[model samples]
Target: MEAVLPIEVEIPSMRVLAETELEEAEWAKQRCEQLNLIDEKRLTALCHGQCYQQRMARAFNARVRHREFKPGDLVLRKVLHITPDSRGKFAYKYDGPFVVKEVFSGGAIILSDMDGTENALPVNVDALKKYYP
Candidate 1:
């Protein structure tokens, strides 16, 4: 039988190496100088950018105004995506041209058919499309 020599393995410690520590220190110094202080001009520019964004958002919202329908008002109800179990599956699609039964805030309108069947459907302000003559 031959004698077998066991091999010894060497492992390094998990601490940060010398070169990596030096590089990290240099990076920290550069970052500290870059963000030392904020000047008045920079602050003013940031504020101006924020204001411009807000104004643009407001203008976009104004273009799509919500139309609230009062009771007895004529409006068209949108056709919804129907499934097999839906009650309106056999009903007329886009069964609008109906009278408004009630009006709610945020542009929601309740409508009733000529046969007195009423549906209170909550819709977004943009969904309430106005039909112009």
Candidate 2:
């Protein structure tokens, strides 16, 4: 005698279960692919951000031009706070009316006081509002 299914009913049910398993495997594979795609997108965005920052930095540096002062040039010096307590006080205020003794490449201007005391002061070109004749 040969083994046989019970009225051929079990065969159909087993086939259905196999089909379900195959579908689950396909779903898992698709999920993995989606995750990889997301990672790739994030990497691309990071690279673009870095490139943008570099471009902006280059443009900012280019827009600024370096200037220096020459000896015997009259320049005004802004008196900054000498000490922490001197802020917002009438004493130790900004003093200028000095003469330029030397200049550096990065807009640094050396000024000499009326008493012939010289000090190197870094000043922006834009900060100098007037030039004396």
Report, for all candidates in order, the number of backbone clashes.
1, 1
RMSD of 2: 13.4
Note the Cα lDDT for every prediction shown: 0.59, 0.63
Model 1, CA-based lDDT: 0.59
Error of 2 at 119 (Å): 4.1
Q: Lowest summed lDDT over 10 consecutive residues: which window, candidate 2?
A: 7-16
Candidate 2 lDDT over 1-133, as tens digits, reads 4344663233223344355565656655755676687789899999999999999999999998754566776766555447666645666443567777776776666667867997655565555533565
Colliding pairs, model 2: 79-94
In angstroms, the error of model 2 at 83 is 12
Off by over 4 Å in 1: 1-34, 38-49, 82-94, 130-133
List the candidates' TM-scores in order.
0.50, 0.50
